[model samples]
Target: MPVDFTHPWVGRTVIYTAAHPNARPEQGIVTSVNVEARIVFVRYGAGTTSKATSVDERLQFLDGSDLILWK
Candidate 1:
């Protein structure tokens, strides 16, 4: 369930999911994919902490459902 770097994820728009299902989902664009560490970096806005991650539990892909939902 790690981030699927095999997909051309960079530059693609995505919805950043929160732990609470009802919480608002922040929208962002994929910036980088670290295949070595299985981390997918996303930029939500122009700020230092804007580069968020689309991962969870160290080995799970938090945006997998988002990818399918958006697709």
Candidate 2:
């Protein structure tokens, strides 16, 4: 499905990148994340019925990435 960019998906994403070198990432829910720069950390696919890829492996936990806020 196409991610609603104008909606509230930025902080409600299912993934988070590491700030430091040793920090880890959080791959929470896969149905609520956007593919932008500020809120998103990676863009490995597009469009509906996209090839299922794990967030844990699709995105890298490196420096200069954003964080994901969950409830």
Candidate 3:
């Protein structure tokens, strides 16, 4: 089974997902961190290698080159 999204590890990881089944680093610049929403709003650009993506349920199984930020 995939790790629980509520796990404390979520804060340590960059982009959370079930595909990786592990914590991965973000490749972009995080403009804002929505702790209440548990979502990271960032700008997808070159400096941040990863593309821009709005994660509905980042803790879910979504996985890709998208970059996100967390608090």
lDDT of 3 by residue, 4-69 (tens): 345432333344433465656443344445454555544433444333345554532234544333
TM-score of each: 0.55, 0.24, 0.30
Candidates in order have lDDT scores of 0.55, 0.39, 0.42
Worst 10 residues of 2 by lDDT: 36-45
Reference-based lDDT, residue 33, model 3? 50
TM-score of 3: 0.30
Candidate 3: residue 52 lDDT (0-100): 31
Against the hidden true structure, what lDDT does model 2 obtain?
0.39
Tens digits of per-residue lDDT for model 1, 1-71: 34454568777776665677587666766766666454567777564443646354222234455332122
For residues 1-71, write the lDDT of model 2, one tens digit per residue: 35443545333334444457886655533333434422332332242332233333434334434343342
